[model samples]
Target chain A: MQRSRLGDLTAFNQLVERYQGPVYNLALRMLSYEAAAEDVTQEVFLSAYRALGQYREGSFKAWLLTITANACRDLLRKRKRRQETSLEEMVETSGDRSVSPSPTPEEYTLRREVQREIQQALNHLSHDHRLAVLLVNLQGLDYGEAARAMGVSLGTLKSRLSRGRAQLREHLLTARGTREP
Target chain B: MFRRRSEPIRHQRVRELLSSYLDAQASERERELVERHVATCEACRRYQEELRDTVQAVRGLPQVTPPRTFTLAQAPRQRMAWALPSWGTPLATATAAALFAVLILGEVTGLIGSPVAHPTAMPSSEALSLKALVQPEAAPEPTPAASDALESLAVQDETPPAATQELSRSSADTSPPPPEEAAQPPLQVPLLPWLQGALGLLAVASGAWWLRRRRAIR
Candidate 1:
């Protein structure tokens, strides 16, 4: 981290390597659009590099996730203001998965289906609630870290997470029921 | 009857706790309460199971590979830091100052536009006659030769206004010019003022732009 702060590209690259997956995944789940998520992930790292001076002693992952969360919020707000988010446009553009193929075709197909449902469920949430769940459960951040990333109190974070989880569970089950029938 | 009424409240509280409980984030007391409640309450247990499954499903999703590595090719930020280089504002300020100086110098030297009105240039005697003649706002009827002489006196040297006034008197005494001759148009207005005004505006605009850019960069 010191080296990266000193403007070491290799050190920063290592940080990017270690954290890109979580950042990209968070963005993807938050946005439910592959291209937009990629764009946000790139933007997050650029800002992280610029803002490294502002980072005090804390969890670097949480700091990076905070940047990711904020960027996602800004993009979502902009998208909303422009009235540019259409369900059909999102579905059409978001289905192109560049993730490396899984070991088995059947497993990959099933996982992709499930992941799509999860992404759709996440999209159905408010930005705060989706971020809360993504940080705590999906990104594996603890309650305190997730709270810090979301800039909310632990109680508020937990409330958002609980609400988010309940909503997500409902959506997934509904989708499953419809799919099966 | 009280147990039945409190049952639904307890169920709601336990359901709220179920999400945190699955993450092992509940307090020890709350954890114990939720565990005991879920153990006996079929509805709370089912809700916990569903929430747990949802969290697990989210966690289990495969990591999406980043489409490309994000290590900036070059320090675009460093480039941005240098975007308005250290010398930029200084250069802009210097340029604006220079332009301002040029404008002031041009005005003082009468190079930019017609010289400021020279009220005291005419001699006292000539001034009385000139003022009397101009009082009626009638154009002077100096002959063509007199007009030519006035132009020459005005242009040939940086003569004080008194000398030109004397010249006009001598010419007026020699031959009062025809009204037709005196009906010539007044001196042409110089375009230099417009040019100088534009330059001044450019200087101000450049300074403003530099200040704005500097603030944004900071």
Candidate 2:
């Protein structure tokens, strides 16, 4: 971090290489779109690089993820401002509800179906709840780290996670029942 | 198990505990209590299992690799380049101050020579009155060209102490001008030098502070 702050491009790129996957995935899940997630991932790294001086010591990953979360939120706000529909609406409109070709293995098909259902269920969550779930459950940050990354208290994290999980479970179960037997 | 309906508050608390327990985030004692309660309680056990599955499903979502290396050759360097001007703010301010001091000094020494102070320039009515008061004996009805020239010179000379003394001498010869006109103090003091010195000090102080901040950041 010190090297990067001193304008070392190699050190900064090393940081980006290490974190790009998690950051990209976080954006993907939060946004439920590949292109938007890609843009946000780049934006997050660029913003992090410029703000390297302001970064304090702690979990670098948490700090990076914090930037990612805020960047995603800002993009979402911009999308909202364009008189565009909510993220859920975007997800629903772009979502693949069509059945896979039979030539594909049934197991792979089922897996893809489940993935889509999970994404749709995630889309139903409010932005905060979705972000909490993405950070803690998907990104594997513990509650404390996730709370810090989300800039919320631990108690608030727990509440959002609990509510988010309950809603997700309900949606998944309902979706599964409708699709499967 | 049927008695669980009578303890709604306890049921809610246990449900919250179960949610945390599934994440392995519950306190040790809370974990123990949740474990014990779920063991005896069918509803709580089912709720815990469902939450656990939900978490697993989310975790099972495959991680996607970024479509491309979100890397750039010179973006950060470009940002640094843009920021270079921000660091030059103090230097710019100091340069501006120096230029302002030069202008003021030139104005004070009449080196830059304001057009308003030229002898051939037209004099306002007030300048004519002051000129009449300063040089009462020169002309009661001087020619237009001479009066205009004399008024201009008188206005230009009005900045010096010698000019004020000359006015006092001329007023002594007259029946004494109105008190308001007499009470007017000379508009010029050694203000230009004082202003130039203050500006120089400010420029030095600003440059020093900027250097100190740059050192601290380094």
Candidate 3:
């Protein structure tokens, strides 16, 4: 990112080509709506472009994801302003419409159940906690990487992730067998 | 939360280090220390299991590739931006050129009469006298009178008064005049353009920045 900001278009392109897929996937996981996720992905990259001059020599992906998390938060805030929500709000949209790879019947059931539980639990979390949880848990970021991606200190990241995971665990446990697989 | 240990050791730092420990990122010495402590600490061991489980649950989420037809691959390539204000940006480069031209013209026609471009520069007494006569402007006062005058000027506009009406108005103007000292606003000569050409360039550059910001918002 630093190289790109220093008048290296090739370096910027290299970053895009390298991280586009994973970033899109992260957005997809966090947002659940393909179109919204795609929009967030674009917003993430656009934000990175504007902030490229501030890039330090470190993990580029972490910075990119932090911006992506911010974009998702903005979208969520916009959604809140509409006084609307997912299907429960009767907003006329279905959830989990973007699961990848054709799943077998059994796999589909488990995936759907997991998806619904996770998404609902995610909605229940505070924005920062959800972001930390998503990056660390769903995106396979270690605490350090998650901290970098969240623009938080490692301790803060761990606290949020642990609290988030505990909440998700509680939510999942409360929903035990309530969702048919 | 305070539980005394038979073998006293640091605890909060160790708990915080659990984040790094779970990720296998702790230094060898730190890792060894944490592992040894965990051996005697049931609470810490359970805490580590919980973190491990949470990590697993998150990792288990389906990596849903967006429905292929709904890819953001169509997302417009974000073009690199400049910090130039659109209207003011051109004024910068043009400013340099224009100022350069003005400076050159002033130098070229200093005392000599250039027939075509500067036939008017030959009046020595005129140039020196105008230079002498131009006085610096003082700052304007912020008074109710000026505001009221501006307001009155705005309000009583464009109606032709009848003769009897004018007579009535003139008759109503019998009040004594307020002090003249309060009426005039001081002249304010802006020193911005002459401050620094480089600063003007910088301002143009800032305008370019503002312009890009506006563009980005759009």
Candidate 4:
């Protein structure tokens, strides 16, 4: 970090510990594979360490997410080569997998269906569009931060999200065999 | 189908501020603009809801807590800050400086000569050496004072011959001032040039030295 105050490993580690969940979550959604997401997350932190000196004030998180996004992209390219994605190998990380005392069978089935569709829709997207959708819609980043995280201008962020969301909508609709809006 | 009204295809250019904005990244202006547009624009509003659903779906993605936090405190790769010890830099700088001075002073003074010469001692050869070590020694220092007024006059005035002739004439016309005084003027004449040349060289060398020191500090 440019600030000498955060120059030590302790501070850097703190950042890793604090933001890892969100960063990993974002990567998981974009990459759609548990292992690849974790790998990308590690690569992102490694990159963040290498680029720590270049870190400017007030943009640390944006800078970090940008790295995370790029790492996701690289993994995607590597995945294309194998033609066998590691998606099925992913350990199910259902946050709410524990039996609920008051869950109706319908709700459980609906959630399971939604999860499958979400994963399918995300995988269907281009990296740019997937990342745009993940950061803005799920990660709750604004256009500017998402744009920054994606290392794009605000316009590009909007375009990707627009296209990405549209694609996602189409995928969800088709999966449900519902009429297109 | 979406239709164009007189309102002119009014829709938020941003259907939804992407998911990252949820973490408080948007400027107030952006939040307000998106808020207002989503309120009035059905297309953007619907997109916002869908965007929300999509993001929520992703969030609900199975959380794969890797068996370990992959980033376990693998000792941080050594950084330049750590690789370069605090004291090591100053030592390196000092060694570099010593080498730089040796090389430069060598070129100027024909190598292995006296490291520095006094201004009033012998300035003629010293000034030439400056143009010689110009690369390392061009930094100028404030001149303490003019070293030799007479030598300066000699080089600047182009009257060395006339000065010599006058000295000869004075010797022939009058009895030399007492031995004590006779030795004084002659001694003073040579020193004037030596002083001037020395001062100039010192000024040039000091300036160069100052710059080197400054750069080392950085």
Candidate 5:
């Protein structure tokens, strides 16, 4: 952290390498577009590099996740403005994924199906609720860390997380019902 | 009747607590209430299990690898390029306007591009020849000899040539020449306006650039 703050590029790149997966996944889950997620991920790292000076003592991963969340939100806002698409509309349009021809084995297919179902459920969530759930469950952040990342109080984070979980539970159950014999 | 009515409200409260309890984020009292309710209520137990499954499914989602490396190709600049404050455009505009006003004032006050003052004119064609010779166009580059000749002309303008001739003849080398204002190079005057104009244009360009950047951000 010290070396990066002193303008050491290599040190900052190391931080990028370490946190890129979590950052990229967070962006991917939040934005739900592969290209935009990649863009937001790149934006997040560059933003973190420039803002290294302002980072005080805390979880660096949480801080980077905060940047990632903010970048995703900004892009989502722009996307909303340009397309004027609401979240519910996006979920309805994008939730159903047609199964691709699986060159991979059965386990991979099953996993992909499960992943798709969860991503659809996440997509169905409101922006704030989705972020709260992702930060805590997907990213494995503690309540405090998730709260910091979401810029909400612990109470608010829990509230959103609870609502988000309830919605996800309903969606997943419906998905399961359709899939079952 | 009270038990049936209160059961639904208790069920609702317990469902809320189950989410936090699953994450181990519930308070001790809330956890105990949820556990006590779920131990007997089949519906609440199923809700807790389903909520837990939802959280686990989300957590189980595979971490997608980034399509490509996100490391910046080059070291970032010292600061965010767009970190300019809202007043940046106005400040640049004000600076440009102030410099423009200064340049205009300079031209209006005759401070810039003013010809050097000729203190006195001799009553002869010698002064006319000197004036013609010293025209900036004719003598674009002033030489030392031209200034010295002008100085001598000024001395002659104040004291008649005949009297200087008599004085020189009487006191061979005793009398000193009178003091005169030094001639200023005309090159300096025209350069001032160009410099100020360049500065004003630079300021205007930067102001425009800042305005465009701010709009793009919005």
Candidate 6:
């Protein structure tokens, strides 16, 4: 962090390489689109690079994820304003929906199907709930760290996480039942 | 009464604590309490199962590698770009202040003449008349015979004879005699423009130095 603040490009790039997966994953889950997630991931790093001076001592991962969340919210707002669509509508209309490649075509199809279902369920949640789930469940941050990232109280974070998980469970179960029948 | 009103809140709090307990995020005491409560509470037990499943499903989602390296180059250029606004704001303000000072100096030194000053160009004649109007003691006294003659002329003209004669006599006595004092040029301070210019140059130089130091550090 000290070297990065002192304008060392190598140090900053090292930090970026270490955290890009988690940042991109957070963006992916928050946005539900591959291309938008990629764009937001890049933006998050660039913004973090510029604001390196303001970085304080703590979990660098939490700080970077906070930036990712804010960037995703901004893009979501822009998408909302442009199309006046709800989160569900935006998810449904998303372009270039793809997952990381699997070894077998059949496995890839199944994995993509499950990912799409989860993404849809995630999109069904309110922004706060979705963020809480992504930070805690997806990004693997603890309750306190997730709360810090979301800028909410610990109780609020737990509430949102609980609600978000319940909603996701309901949707995933319903989807499974429909497919099986 | 208060406990009755807060009963629902307490129940919700317990449920949330139980949710945390399922995730292993609750304290030992809270975990024991939640465990005890969930054993008896059918709805909470169901909620706990749902939360567990939700977390499991989320964790089961695929994590993807980044498509490409997000490594950044052009460190100096990017740093400069960010530095622009931080350095630019105060420099812009200083430039504005310098321009304002120059404009004021220009007006003061008559390089940019004012409208009020233009009307007062023939200062000698205007000054003499103002002096005469303002100094009644300097005027000569009116003669008795002259006042009597003017009174007769006013009566023939059928005006307020005595009052008209007194006003005429006073005007004639107080009318300024010309060409007594020579016109003097207004005072000019030679140091003013030089001082303003030096100050403006100093501000610009300091601002440039500050920006240069910022760029070098980056």
Q: Which ten residues in a row have the lowest lDDT in candidate 4 chain B?
A: B181-190
The digit string of per-residue lDDT tens for model 6 on B20-63 reads 77778888898887887778878777877776877777887777
Tell how far residue A2 is off in model 5, in angstroms.
0.2
Instruction: Tell me candidate 1's fraction of native contacts, as a decimal between 0 and 1.
Output: 0.49
TM-score of each: 0.62, 0.61, 0.53, 0.50, 0.62, 0.60
Candidate 2, which segments miss by more than 4 Å at Cα? A85-89, A92-104, B1-6, B77-218
* Candidate 1, position A65, lDDT: 87
Q: Candidate 4: count the clashes.
A: 30
| Model 4 interface RMSD over true interface Cα atoms | 7.8
Pick the winner on lDDT between candidates 2 and 5. 5
**Candidate 4 Cα errors over 4 Å, as ranges:** A1-7, A86-106, A178-181, B1-67, B70-72, B79-218
Model 1 stretches with alpha carbons more than 4 Å out: A92-104, B1-5, B78-218
- What is the Cα-based TM-score of model 1? 0.62
- Name every residue pair that clashes in candidate 2: none
Error of 2 at B170 (Å): 40
DockQ of each: 0.32, 0.28, 0.22, 0.15, 0.31, 0.31
Ranking the candidates on DockQ from highest down gives 1, 5, 6, 2, 3, 4
Q: Who wins the lDDT comparison?
A: 1
Model 3 per-residue lDDT tens digits across residues B109-146 = 54212212223332354433332222112323324544
The TM-score of candidate 3 is 0.53
Better of 3 and 5 by lDDT: 5
How do the residues B1-218 of candidate 4 rate in per-residue lDDT, one tens digit apiece? 86543343345345445433443555687678677766787877776676666656655555444433645365456344443334654555565566557546645764233334444433366343432332123324313232233335445656555433343333334343345423332211233445545544665565565454333221
lDDT of 1: 0.76
Which candidate, 5 or 6, has the higher TM-score? 5
